[model samples]
Target: MSSKLEQKIAEFRITFIAEFNDKLAVLTKLWSNARTSQSLEAVKKFRFEVHSLKGSSGALNFLTLSNRLGIIEEKIAPCEEQINSLKTVIPFIDRHMNSMNEASRNTPNSLLVLQEAASLLGELRDPQKNKEEITPQSYRDIKIALIDDNENTSAVNAKLLAGFGFTINQFNSIEQLEKVLQKNTYNLVLIDTDNSTNPSEKMFAFAVKLRTFDTDVFILSSSSSFENRLSAVRSKVNEYLLKPVNITTLVSKIRKNFKIDLIRPYRILLLDDQALVGSFYKTLLEDEHVEVLAISKADAIMTELESFHPDVFLLDMHMPNISGLEVARLLRQQAKYDYVPIIFLTSDDNIKTKLEVLECGADDVISKSTPPNIIVQQVDSRIQRGQEIRYLASRDSLTGVLNHGQIMDAAAHSLRLSKRQEKPAVVVMIDLDHFKGVNDKYGHLGGDKVLVSLGQLLLQSVRDTDYVGRYGGEEFMVVFSNATPRVIESKMNNILTAFLHINYTVDKQSFNCSFSAGLASSTDHEKLSELISSADAALYQAKDAGRSQICVDVLNK
Candidate 1:
């Protein structure tokens, strides 16, 4: 039995090597044909063959074989270049074919070399072929049905596939195929055209009906003529192989179509603990396209969160080590990941819990019982909203500067810390003098344009550490941290001078605008309000004395 097994293994290796030679010949023929014809149709067909063989060769780990093919592809790089025609490409294909043929015949260890060549050629043809080796899966229980009036063809095809470890069913008629299909779900179906006199029309009609059975169809054709091929494609056959078919070619087609690539399903940590609910959610998330990772373990939250940078999270509210709120909070505390969105998935309808979860920095809160479609929508909406909020929070919606509120809040915090460290903070209050006149003259719209311009000017004038804000309409506040009185006064004066020369156009008339300024020191007052108020008094003095002048009020005078 062991000796028999050894013989089978040796035979299989010989067959594999032989098939490699056949693929090489086929590739050369296609390439040479493509070069000779130099038609768009020929190139398209050649590309299809190259792509298919690349996938097969990569699967078989024929790197060197693939790379040599890649050399042909690269030489024919600009496939659209009509200038050269097939003259150069045809010779290249012929040479490569000859070299591969010689290597296959003479070298004993050439099989390994040929395999490597195939892999390289495959990689050259498709960069994605560089993926890790795939294990050919063993199928102990895969049920499939074969539908064809030709019993001999059906049995032969089934036996060939069965050798590759597929469990197949052979049926002689559409009626028999339908009966088996009603009882079993098949990964594939094989249909033969030999028995039907008007095969193409009948095959097309049968394919339309068989689609309802959810089985992929593989058509067996006696020839690869354009008429037959067109009908096969129109019927949406997963594969169409010409007969007296090469069993290896049939096996390759079955393996290519029926074999699952076994891509690891994306590991998603679903924080929900609900039993079938979590699995249902997972199933819904798994579109035919993406891998999904769904887990219900509440305790391994950190581990899961760390390992899987999920496209999204469906985090449940009530978990053991930490509530979803706490988890979200912890996620936000990490500097590297604070912005990662955590959507709270909860069944709790309590408004308070929802609010708390949101306040704890959850990107969004979604109901556990939310529809799968709604969940996807919510996830998308949450990501979009988070981005918008981040932008709005840092920006002034009106003038597009830092908003006065945020600026003041930042200033207050920074001022407190600076004062604790015995550092000085200079505060300046800027009032746009006669700004009301701009509105009155140009309408509010023109005034808005001026205000926006002023915001830009102020933003540009400030140092990196200096903060500016729109205090109120026509009033701006600036806080200069670590500035001495002299430096603050110089900067304030420069700003006033810059505004005096700023030319604004309105109604085809040029207008030069100016602003009144005020200054105070952090040493004068600990509170931002107090410093602002003192600066306001200085500003009043500037307005009272005459507009467009700077004033400093050491005391409220």
Candidate 2:
């Protein structure tokens, strides 16, 4: 068989074993309780547990184990009727439970036990079906409404959001918005408050109306005045953005409020020589929704490790060609996987052995007898910490966007891609309008909020394929792939329109903020620096034209 196919089967085996182990653990407990209680209810519970185990084991292709469990379940079936005959049933229960435990410890022996148990029970039918079970349904469809008078702004926002799998409906008037809200449910309502007279009152009333329908509201306004912010607070607006809002920030806010994560499942690489033991560990991790790749041959470990890019490594101490300690050392030599957790699983309880393993680069040592729940918890904790560390290293501390170096690196990569594909990529230099004035008026804390808000806006506005970053204080940058100068300008304009409506408050005083952006496309320059410089120059022109507008650089071909 092909290595890939073999690996796939091994992975499935691991997952099945993990699940079976958990079921067995529960069955062990239930059996013990049933024996002591000797009640009809206890017997029924035991039967149900065994029945479930039979079905699951069968579904996972553990036919031997399934058949054995099925026989045991069948024997317990008549226990409720023969509840008074507890003494007679207890011996049968104990015998089966001991056989099952022994079979679990040695999977190969399970078939022999199954045959013996079947003979004693007379006839045993297959408990597993041929087909796989259906997966549960995913998250429901997410729909949003973008209400704004500017058709250009609405269209751009709608297009960007639609790319994120949202159904967007545009509305130019409150009446039109109300009509849609009354007729259909929307996950979120994004309204442009720039045209409203008494924007605060209008927003509050609109929010009140939305609340009746249990809809989330986001307001877009050019003014960040005290009254407006207070109104948003009163109306419990989910998000308040200034006109020319960052599309990235808007999308992020929507996702945050809605609790959405695009990151895939945590991946784990398991290394063990014993197929059964490796499969068991793999199953344990998979039960926690982790993606695991199990490799029995030490020679295949590096290949699997490189391909899987696992967040954590589970290694068995004793192997044919290579020890777990040696594998950990080999992994540690690779700089990329340096911080990746290496957990050693072994039956060896020797203190000297564990210390030696740790010294050899294993992060933690787990006994083979460790409970499934504890194993999962330890692995999850380590993975989470690793992720958190990576996040902090890659993200801006305050705004939670890409830091300067990370953004530049991303831009460089995007530029390389653009050059290779011969596709146009645009970079926008963004500056918050009158940002210093905000600090002077409301202190640095308020200014920080404006910066954070803009950062969030830019992060949300850009496509997942695009890169947005905090360039420096009061400035940001967005790298858009396969975008023309005109398209970038239009999108930035839409962001500007939305950004102007963001409200900020300081000691009862409220104000709004705006931003000016300059767009430069890859067609203008071969280098990221040149593109950024051109964008910066155009951004100055935007400021000169008056704040809160997007300007495109007139690049000579």
Candidate 3:
């Protein structure tokens, strides 16, 4: 593998150095056009050559020649003010090309040219290079407590939440829950109640006590009377869910309240009119584990680009019919891709043209002759930062997971692809049983720890191709591409078990938690909303059937 990579690198280096003189000749011709007609296109074309040669020359240890070429790149910058400067610089470029070619292959006659280029660089690059500045920038398992005097309900709820990426513990009494709270924390707590006209004093007292711990407390009653509601408020209960609970509503609340930062694979779009060059570059990038879509034509790219949805655009600075500048402008005009970064791999060195490209909505520009290592680093760093920016804007801050809108957007995208490919897709809706009880007993801070924990767990546990996001409160949505119900069921089981075993602590006290999940596949519903609704319905079934389990919509049907 190492040898193969080395061989590829060696061949790439040679190819990287190919067409040097030919490019230099092109630069000379463009220089003439720029000098005579003051043509910006000529300078734009000129950069395609000199900028590449500049890097190649520098890479081969020819500093003076490279720097000299660099000067011409700046001179031909597509600016009206600098267009006239080309005439004077043309002679400079001419003499250096001659001097560079005349020099012995082994020893460069660079001492004089190097000094002159150094002087030119000092005048050109100072106080004007500010392109790579991005202003600064995980999910954890959620722990929950289901406090119900009824063993059946509490146990079932605990297991239900556990299946969905929450760690839940069932306590039959507030006293039992208090002992766990003393040492362990929970993000939510659920107190089960009956439809009696008068509130149970003991249950109300426990709810108030749990509030002191800063946990989110909820009372689940079989009644929704005003008196019952007022009693909950007076008891300091955080929320009141009428039984039988709509599991989807409860899960949505959880998702909205908690956060998780999920990871998804990012890809790049490479636009180079040169098919061979684009192919080789694509291969090089792929070897580094970068996903890239390389295109040689500027026409008919919008649709492909829309579907590809690249994180970064790698473009050749100039093309024949439609220049890179025009393409960049077109991309900027679209709201959908406004945040994606555009980087030009060009031979143009004109400071003006660089600024022009920037104005066209590009992120950065690099010479094509840059070392592969540096180029790779450049692409990687930009992708990382661009993704960070993109995700931050759409994710829940604490958990770093997609928020409702973002997750739904992901769902819509998946639906489109799955429908097109005629492949299966799945949506899993998860909820924690008696979640408010966990929050109430553990206090808000402890509750937060649980949410963060659950968020991190889903992100780390799921496949890179999967999408994890908080649908609301403690409820989460996971969308799997090209996956069957069986696949989802197996995946959910592992996540549930993992949550069930996570030991949580508050003030050195320890406890555990669990969750429940409901999964629906594309076979059940073709529309995005219908699919989610189906999964949500299945979630209710899981809770009804007893928590800490997963319910499949198709299987039930």
Q: State the C-alpha lDDT per candidate.
A: 0.63, 0.71, 0.70
Native-structure RMSD, model 3: 14.4
Against the true structure, whose TM-score is highest? 3
List ranges where model 2 is wrong by over 4 Å: 1-362, 365-372, 409-427, 462-467, 479-491, 519-538, 551-557
lDDT of 2 by residue, 367-416 (tens): 65444445666887887666556555666765667789878977887787
Q: For model 1, what is the C-alpha lDDT against the true structure?
A: 0.63
lDDT of 1 by residue, 341-394 (tens): 677765444588778977987766765434334565566555445433433465
What 10-residue stretch in candidate 1 is worst by lDDT?
Answer: 127-136
Q: Between candidates 1 and 2, name the one with more favorable lDDT.
A: 2
